[model samples]
Target: MIYAQILAGGKGTRMGNVPMPKQFLALADKPILIHTIEKFCLEPRFDAILVVCPADWLSHTQDLITKYVTDSRVKVVAGGSERNATLMKGIRYLQETFGRHADDVVVTHDAVRPFVTQRIISENIDAVLQHPAVDTVVPAIDTIVQGEADAISAIPVRSSMYQGQTPQSFNVKALVDAYATLTDEQKASLSDSCKICLLAGQPVTMVRGENLNFKITTPYDLRVASALIEKRA
Candidate 1:
C-alpha cells in the first residue's frame, strides 16, 4: 500500500496577504499544488496520492485537481491544525480506506515544494524499505547558527549539518504505532513526523536531495520557481 501524502494545510501568512495559500498560487502554467501532485502521479508505485489541505480550502483544492490532474490516484482531504496533525489525518485516512500494513509505505511531501525531483522520491521510497523512517536532506552549504533572544546560542559544524527536504518516507504501520506510544510532552517536542519515529527508538535513514528542490514560501521563491519553469520550457 504505497502512498504519497502531500501536506498542504497552511494559511500562507508568510506569503504576505495572498488571496489563496502559496500552494494554490500559479507556478508557470499551473498551480504549485498541481505541479507538486503531478510529480507523484508520474510515479505509478503509489497506490494513492493524498492531498491534505485546510478544511476551508478543501473544495477549492478538489476543484483544482479536477481541472488540472487527470490521474485517478489523487484524492483531496481537509488537513489538521498542525503539520504533524495533518499527517495523522492522512495516516488515518489510509487506515480507513486501505487498512494498515507494517511494510506499507507513505512518502510525505510538502505541497509547496514543486521542485522535488523523481530521484528524491525514488530514494525515499527505497530507503523506507530497510529502515522504519527516511528523511530527505541536502548537505548544508551555509554555516548553521542556533540562536536565542537575538544572540547566538550555538554554531553547529557545517559539515555535520544537513538541510531537510521532504518526501520523508516511512513504514505506515511502524509510524502509526510509534506515534501512539509518544507522551504529550514528546509529541509537543516533535519538529517533524520523523522525530516521532526517532523519539520512539525507530531508526531513520537519510537520502541525499537536490538543492533546487525548495519549498516555495516567499515571493522570492515564487520568482525563482517561475524562472526555473521557464528555463525548463
Candidate 2:
C-alpha cells in the first residue's frame, strides 16, 4: 500500500512571528495544508494519506481534514521533534498500522507546498517502482554560493545544482533499513531524507519539479501564493 505523509509540524519561525504556524495560514478560502492535502486526495494510487502535524495541533488538523476534505483516506497524525523524526513517525505509523513490505511506497511532502503538480507525483510513483528512492527537484537558476559566516567557501557550478522540493518518495522497507544505520550524530545533522538512502548505499532517482511548486515559508511567499492561486482560478 502507498502512503502520503504530509509534514506540517513547523512553528513558523521564518514567517516573522505569525500568530499561527504557516501551514495553518489562509491561502484564499482554505488553509495551506488543506490545499496541499487536496492535491493528493485525488490521486487514486494512494491507499492511505497521513497528515502529520505538531502534537498540539493534532485535533485542529483533524478538524481541518473533516471540514475541508471529503475523502476517508486522509487522516491526521502528530509529528516528532524535528523534520526527519516527524517523517519517521509517519513511516512507523504506516509500518505498525498497514504492516511493512519491501515494495510499499511513502510519498513525503511539505504541508506548505500546495502547488505540487500531478505530473511530478506520477513520475515519482513511476520512478520508485525501479529505484528504492526518488526526490523532486528543479534545476537551480541562480549561481549557488556556499559560504560560512560571511565568508565564501565555494561557488558551485550552476548547471549541476538543483533546488529540492517534496514528494520525496521511498520504498518503505528500504527507508526503514537505511534510517537504522545512522549514528545519533549523523541523524541529528540530516535535513534531507534522500541522504538517508544514500548513507545506506542506495541510489536515489530524480524527478523534475516545477518552480511554481514552491514552499510558502514567508509572508512574501504567502503573497505570491495568493496571487498564483487567484491566477489559477
Candidate 3:
C-alpha cells in the first residue's frame, strides 16, 4: 500500500499574525494545504492520503478537505506537538485503519510546501521501491556556513551539501522501527524525519528537487510563494 501523509501540525509562529496557520493561508485560489493535497490527488497512485493537522484545527482541516477536495482516499487526523510525533500519528493511523504491511510505503510531506510537483511525488514513490528511504533535495547554490551566535565556525564543501526537502518516502515498518529506537530527548531535537533514519543507521537516497518546492515559513517566503503563484497564473 502507498500512503501520503500531509504534516500540517505546525503553529506557523514565524508567519506573524496571519489569522490562520501557514498551511491554511491562501496561495493562488486555494488554501496552502489544499494546494499540497491536490498534488497527491493528481498522482492517483496513493492508496490512502492522511492529513495530520493540529488538534485545534482538526474540524477546520476536515472542513477544508470536504469543501475543496473531492478525493475519497483522504482522511484527517489531529497531529502532535512536534513533526515527528505528528508523523507517528499518521503512521499509527495507517496501521490501525489499514494494517501494517512490509512493502507499504508512506510519503510524508509538509503541508505548507504547496509547490511540490507531481514528478517529485511520483519519483519518490518509484525510488522508495528500491531503497528503504528516499528524500528529495536540491543542491546548495550558495556556500554553506556553520555558525555560532557570534561567529562563523566553518564552511562546508558546496558540492557535498544539499538542502533536504520533503515527500520523504520510506518503508512504513522501517520508519516506525526507527522512531521506536529514539529517546525522548532525541525525539525533541528532530527537525527532519530523514535525520531519524540516519540516526537509526539507515541510508537515505536523494532525489533532486525543484527550486520552487520551498516551505512557506516566514513573511518573505509567503511573498515569494504568492508571487510564484501569480506568475504561474
Candidate 4:
C-alpha cells in the first residue's frame, strides 16, 4: 500500500510571531497542513497517511485532523527533534503497523507545502513505479550564479540545476535502508529526505513541481502563500 508521510515537526523559527508552527497556522480558511493532507487523501492510490509532528503539538494536531480530515486511515504520531529523525520515526511506525512487506511506496512531504496539486502527486507516483531511483524535483528557472562572501564568483549553467522539494516518493524499503545507514554527521548536514537516498548512490529522477508548492518558512513566504491561495480561490 502506498503511504504519505507528512513531516510537520518544524518549530516555525523563521515565521516570527506565528503563534503556532507554520503548518498549523491558518491559510485559506484551514490549517496549512490540513490542505496538504487533504490533497493526498483525495487520491485513491494512497491507502493511508502518517503525519509526524512535535510531541508537544500532538493534541493540537489531533484536533485539527478530527476537524478537517476525519479519515480513519490517517495517523498522527509524535515526531523527533530533527527533520530526519522525525521521518525515521514515521517510517518505523509505518513498518510496524502496516508490515514491512506492504507495497512499500512511501512519499515524504513537507506539511507547509499545502499547494502541492494532485497532478504532481500522481506524476511522482507514476515515476516511482517505473524507475527504482526517482525523486520529484523542479528545475531552477532563473539564471544561476555562485557567490562568495559579498561578490559573484562563478556563473554556473542553470540548465542542470534543480531545487529539491517534497513529496519525495521512494520505495519504502529503499528509503528506510538508506536512512538507517546515515551517520551523525551525515544526518546533521542532510537538508532534505531525498538526499539520504542519493547519498546511498541512488539516482533520483525529477518530476515537475508547482511553484505554489513552495514551503512557508518565513513571514514573506507566508504572505506569498496566502496570496497564492487567495488568487486561486
Candidate 5:
C-alpha cells in the first residue's frame, strides 16, 4: 500500500496570530492544504491519503476535505505535538486500519507545502522501490554557514550541502523500526524524518527537488506562494 501522510499539526505561531493555521490559509481560492492534497490525489499512485491535523482542528480539516476533495481515500486524524509524534500516530493508524507491509510506501509531507510536484512524488516512490527510504532535496544555491551567538563557527562545503524537501518516502516496516529505536531524548529532538533513517544506519536515496517546493512557514512564504500560483494560472 502507498500512503500520503500529510502533517498539519503546527499552531501557525510563526504566522503572527492568524485566526487559522497556516495550512488552512487560502493560497488563492482553495486552502493551502487542499492544494497539497490535490497534488497527491492527482498522482493515482497513492492508495490512501492520511492527514494529521491539530486536535482542535480535526473537524475543520474534515470540513475542508469534504468541501474540496472528491477522493474517498482521504482520512483525517488528530496529530500529536511534534512532527515525529504526529507521524507515529499516522503510521500506527495506517497499520491498524489497513495493515502494514514491509514493502508498503509512506510519503510523509508538510500540509503547508502546496507546491510539491507530482514529479517529485513519483521520484520518491520510484526511488523507494530500490532503497528502503528516500528523501527529496534541492542543491544549495547559496553559501551556508554554521554560526553561534555572534560568530561564524564553520562554512560547510557548498557543493556537498543540499536543502531537504518533503514527500520523504520510506518502506513501512523500515520507518516503524527506525522510530522504535529512538530514545526519549532523541525522540524529543526529532525534526526531520530522514534523520531517523540515518540514525538507524539505513541508506536513503536522494531525488532532485524543485525550487518551488518550499515550505510555507512565514507570511512572506505565503505571498510568494500566491504569486507562484498566479504565475502558474
Candidate 6:
C-alpha cells in the first residue's frame, strides 16, 4: 500500500505576522494543508493518507479534514517536537492503524507544499520502486554558492545540482529501522526525515521535480503561492 504522510508540525515562526502556522493559513479558498492533503486524496495511487500536526492542533486538523476531505482512508495524528519526530509518529500510526508492513512505500511530504502535482507524486513512487538503493531527488536549476557570510564563495560544478523536495518516497521498513538506530545527538540535530536516512549512510537518488512544489514558509511565500494558484486556476 502506498501511504502519503504529510508533516504539518511547524510553528510558523518564519511567517512573522501570520497568526497561525503557515500550513493552517488559507490560500485560494482553503487552508494550505487542506489543499495539500486533497492533492494526494484525489490521486488513485495513494491508498491512504496520514496527516501529522502539532499535538495542540490535532482536533483542528481533524475538523478541517472532515470538512474538506471525505476520503475514509485519511487520518489525523498528533505530531512530535521536530520534523523527524513528527514523521516517525505518522509512520508508527500508519503501521498500527493500517497494519502495513515496513516494506510498504511511505511518501513523506511537507504540508505547506500545496502545489505538489499528481505527476510528481507518481514519478516519486515509480523511482522509489525501481531504485531501492537510491532516494530520488529533483535536479537543481540555480547556481549553488557555498561559504561563510561575506566570504561566501561559489563552487563551480559541471553537473547541475538538484534541490531536494518531498514526497520523498521510502521503503517503510528501511525508514523505520533507520530511525531506530539514530543517536541522541544525531536525532537532536537532524531536521528532515531524508536527512536521517542520509546520515545512516543511505544513498538518495534524483527525480525531476516541478517548481510549483516550493514550500510555503514566509508571508511572501503565501503571496507567491496565491499567485501560482490563481495562474493555474
Which TM-score value belongs to model 1? 0.97
The digit string of per-residue lDDT tens for model 5 on 1-233 reads: 88889999988889886899999999999999999999989888888899999999999999999998999999999998888889989999999999868788899899988999889988888888788899899999999999999899999999999999998998989988988998888877777998898988899889999998999999999899999999989
- Supply every candidate's count of residue pairs whose N, Cα or C atoms clash at under 3 angstroms: 0, 0, 0, 1, 0, 6
lDDT of 4 at 217: 90
Stretches off by above 4 angstroms in model 1 are none
Query: In terms of lDDT, which candidate is stronger, 3 or 5?
Result: 3
lDDT of 4 by residue, 112-214 (tens): 9888889988887888776544666778898888899989999878998887788788887777778778887888889877788888877778888877778
lDDT of each: 0.91, 0.91, 0.92, 0.85, 0.91, 0.82
How high is each candidate's TM-score?
Answer: 0.97, 0.98, 0.97, 0.93, 0.97, 0.92
RMSD per candidate (Å) reads 1.0, 0.9, 1.0, 1.7, 1.0, 1.9
Query: By lDDT, is 3 or 6 better?
Result: 3
- lDDT score, residue 122, model 3? 92
Q: Looking at model 6, report the run of 10 residues with the lowest lDDT sum.
A: 131-140
- Cα lDDT tens digits, model 6, 43-123, are 787778889999998899999999988998888889988887788888888888779664588888899988888888888
How much is 123 displaced in model 1, in angstroms?
A: 1.1
* CA error at residue 95 for candidate 5, angstroms: 0.6
lDDT of 2 by residue, 1-233 (tens): 78889999988899997888999999999999999999998889999999999999898899988898999998878999999999999988888888977789989999999999889888888888788999999999999999999999999999999999998999988999999998998897798989999888899999999999999988999999999989989
Q: List the residue pairs that clash in candidate 1.
A: none
Cα shift from native, residue 66, model 3 (Å): 0.9
Candidate 3: tens digits of C-alpha lDDT, residues 48-166: 99999999999999999999999999999999878888998889999999987899999999999999998999999999988889999999999999999979999999999999899
**Candidate 6 — which pairs collide?**
102-173, 135-205, 137-206, 137-207, 140-161, 140-162
Instruction: Write down the worst ten-residue block by lDDT for model 1.
Output: 94-103
Q: Which stretches of candidate 3 lie over 4 Å from their true place?
A: none
